[model samples]
Every structure is written in structure tokens, then in C-alpha cells.
Target: MSTAIVALCFSGPTLADDVSPELVAFARTQAAHIAARTDVIEHIIAQNTNHAHLTLEEISRLDVHWRQQYGSQDSPLIHRLMNTPLSDALRSLQLRSSELITEIIIMDNRGLNVAQSSVTSDYWQGDEAKWQQTFLLGPGAEHVGELGRDESTGSIQIQVSRTVTDHNGHPIGAVTVGVAPLQF
Candidate 1:
């Protein structure tokens, strides 16, 4: 019984274990999916010194690791980030390539939704899967969750994210992208 108790205590991750196989697999699959497409959203994150690809801290969370932060209502980034409608973005991706990227949400350090590809109009970006990994519980490597759903799809959506950084490599935010694994 004492051994059982010890096993239970050691069962879950304690911020030292290497990232789970599931997470690593999801990350690889997401990168591959995005890489397979060119006209659609590119996995490429670098543009210039001012513009950059998302960072490991930004793109690491997926379905299981709940996000944990949100942007301030008084911030201008909230306005600029959320400016793009989810419908428009989804439509563009859908029209551009045969590849699939069903939803995309901008998550802050706290995991709140700054912007999304669809739904989430009123900012539901706090302590959810996409935002939580970077801010909470682990050795601080990238994470990926298995397929899951939101209020709308009722289908499996693969979540992907990386830490967003500035030109000086300062951590700024996170970006989460979701794609339907198997459309029903």
C-alpha cells in the first residue's frame, strides 16, 4: 500500500519528464501538415527582424494543456489582433489550398483568446489548453494535445502553438492553430 501511494504520487509529470510522446507526435504532425501546404497557412514563421515566426513558447500548447492568460481590454493589441474576423481567415485558408486549418486563435501569456479563425467573439482566452502550457506545469518545453473540440465543431481538432518572441528574442505572446484531423 505504501508503494502504491508512492506510485500514485509519482504518476503524473513533475516538471522534469521529457515531453510526452503524444505531444511530440502532435507537434511533428502539425508541422508536417502545414509544411505540406504552400498556398494555405505556412508553418514558416520568419519574415524579417520585425516580423517572425511563432516561438516554441507560443506554439507549444495543444488540446489537453489548458491555456492560462488573456490580453487586457484596454490594450491596442487586442483591437489590432482581433481585427481579423475568424470567418474571413478560415475562408481564405479554405479557398487557398486543399489543406486544412480549421481554426486559429491568438493566445497571450495567460492563454486568453486575442483572435480566432471562427467563433469566440467575446474573448474566451484564459487558462485554456493553448495558453496554459507555457505559463504552467512543466520543464517548459513545447506541448501538443490530442484532437478535441470546442463549442462549435463537435469534431476532433488538432491544436498547435509556439511562443511568440520579439526581434531581441524576448518572449511576448503565443499563437495557437487548430486543424480538423478527421472531418465528419
Candidate 2:
């Protein structure tokens, strides 16, 4: 973790026509800010490199395990991800937003979670549009997911995802921020 301060902005075209401009702007600002953090970038890079050799079968296994242990207190994998400093930072960011942000998930190149504000339903997001439309799309790419109700919080929110690029401007990962439009 070099903690290098980089100035980055979301330069992609908005992908969701139904999402309001204000919500999109808010999401983009949060995504760009997170993308510019060296700690986040480094963590994603390290995780991506570490899991680069995992086969699809291995990924599915992990995903299945994660789903089985989603809300379990004894889940080793979920416990590891939720207790990290990066997860704490994400939680703090969500709290400080005064309910505008509901959740945040940082994903590696392969769509495995590097950090998250809270426990997600599943582990592998590689098959989801959030990752496919962003990390797989290239640098500056964004995907605004459809509006949905958050089960835990009972709030209507939209997931905004953007490609997280390294200092050299290469796509290394993706970040999805859950935003509640009504919070604005």
C-alpha cells in the first residue's frame, strides 16, 4: 500500500438511461474517488494476481460456498473480507454519506470481492453486468444497474459500477456503489 494520491475522474458515457443525472453524478464521484486510492488499487491488483490461475470450476465452488455461508457467523471467507481495513473504510464511507450510499463492493479483475461494506449475497460477480460492463469493458467504463430494493435496509437503491484503473490507466478492477436516490 503506497497510498499514492492520484487525481482521476469517470470519463465514460453513462450506461443507464433510467437513472437520474444526479444519482449518476453522485455514483461517478464516489467511483472516481475510490479508484484513485492507491490502497484500493493495490488490494485489487494483489487479489487479481493471486487468483488469476483459478479455473471456472474453482470460482463456482467459491461462489457456492459463499452463498451457503452468506449470513453465517462462522464463515471464514466472509469473516475475512468483512473485517479488513478496506471494508472498514467502505463502511465508513457509506455511513458518512448520510444514507445516500447503502453499500460498496470492490471487486478484483475476475470479479471476486476484494472488499465490501457489508456481506453480499454471493462472491463471484464476474458473471454479472456490474463487472461485465465495467472491468471487461475497459477503462472509464461504467454500468448503472436497475433500481431495486435492498432487502436488509428496505431501501430503494441502484447499483453504480465503474472500472477501477491502475496508475498507468489500465483496468484492474471494478467498484459497485449502492446509492439511494431518495437520500439526496
- lDDT by residue for model 1 over 125-174, one digit each (tens)? 44565556643432232445554454543434556655554444444445
Q: What tens digits encode model 2's per-residue C-alpha lDDT throughout 1-184?
A: 1111111012222234555678778988998898789989999989988998999999999999998898777799889888999999999999999989988999999899999998888899999999999999999899888666655455667788999999999999999998876566
lDDT of candidate 2 at residue 31, scale 0 to 100: 81
Candidate 2 Cα outliers beyond 4 Å, as residue runs: 1-16, 151-154
Q: What is the alpha-carbon RMSD of candidate 2 to the true structure?
A: 9.1
The lowest-lDDT stretch of 10 consecutive residues in candidate 2 is 1-10
TM match of model 2 to true structure: 0.87
Give the TM-score of each candidate.
0.47, 0.87
Best by TM-score: 2
Scanning candidate 1 in windows of ten residues, the lowest lDDT window is 39-48
What is the model-wide C-alpha lDDT for candidate 2? 0.84
Q: Which predicted model would earn the best lDDT?
A: 2
